[model samples]
Target: AQSVAQPEDQVNVAEGNPLTVKCTYSVSGNPYLFWYVQYPNRGLQFLLKYITGDNLVKGSYGFEAEFNKSQTSFHLKKPSALVSDSALYFCAVRDFWSGGYNKLIFGAGTRLAVHP
Candidate 1:
């Protein structure tokens, strides 16, 4: 089984300051990690993914995440945050050995609050 943990229930950051949201995972074998964001009353939208490649991966909206295999962590970072960046963020893990079916297990989620 694969699972993700976002220890923080919420992250508070001031506008124009850099922000980071932490995520960790546990799974057997290689893990496919993903990040998604959700706005008010809107469905979750894909933000970034770590399938294979460089340890550092960049995604939409000036967000980036570093994959640490040893730590089993993929923490989301933004150079500078905006008030509009306030949203719900989720970390998900996918296990390929799950009987050939695509199953994504999501974290409890971390709410980002960007105060102006």
Candidate 2:
């Protein structure tokens, strides 16, 4: 089964500092990986995705992620953090056999606390 795990329940970072929210996954064959952010009571905002190609992929709000095939991990990263960036993050994965619905299997979610 394809699955994702976010080891951290929360990450604390001061505004303007680099930040990272770790994520790892398990899947058979190739998997489609994604990162999403959500503010309280709001739907998830797409951050980035790793289909194939470059190991490092950049996305909205200056966010980026590196896909490590060897480790089966896709960790979100940013050069600098913002207080407004504080929110809930989730890592997701979907396998080809799961159909083309983009029906993702997500992690428990990580809270990013960015202090100004």
- How many clashes does each candidate structure show, in the order listed? 0, 0
lDDT (Cα, tens digit) per residue for candidate 2, span 21-108: 9999999888799999999999999999999999999999999999999999999999999999999999999865777788788999
Root-mean-square deviation of candidate 1: 1.1
Pairs clashing in candidate 1?
none
lDDT of 1 by residue, 1-99 (tens): 568999999999999999999999999888889999999999999999998999899999999999999999999999999999999999998876778
lDDT of 1 at 34: 94
Stretches of candidate 2 exceeding 4 Å from the true structure = none
Report how far residue 53 has shifted in candidate 1, in Å.
0.9
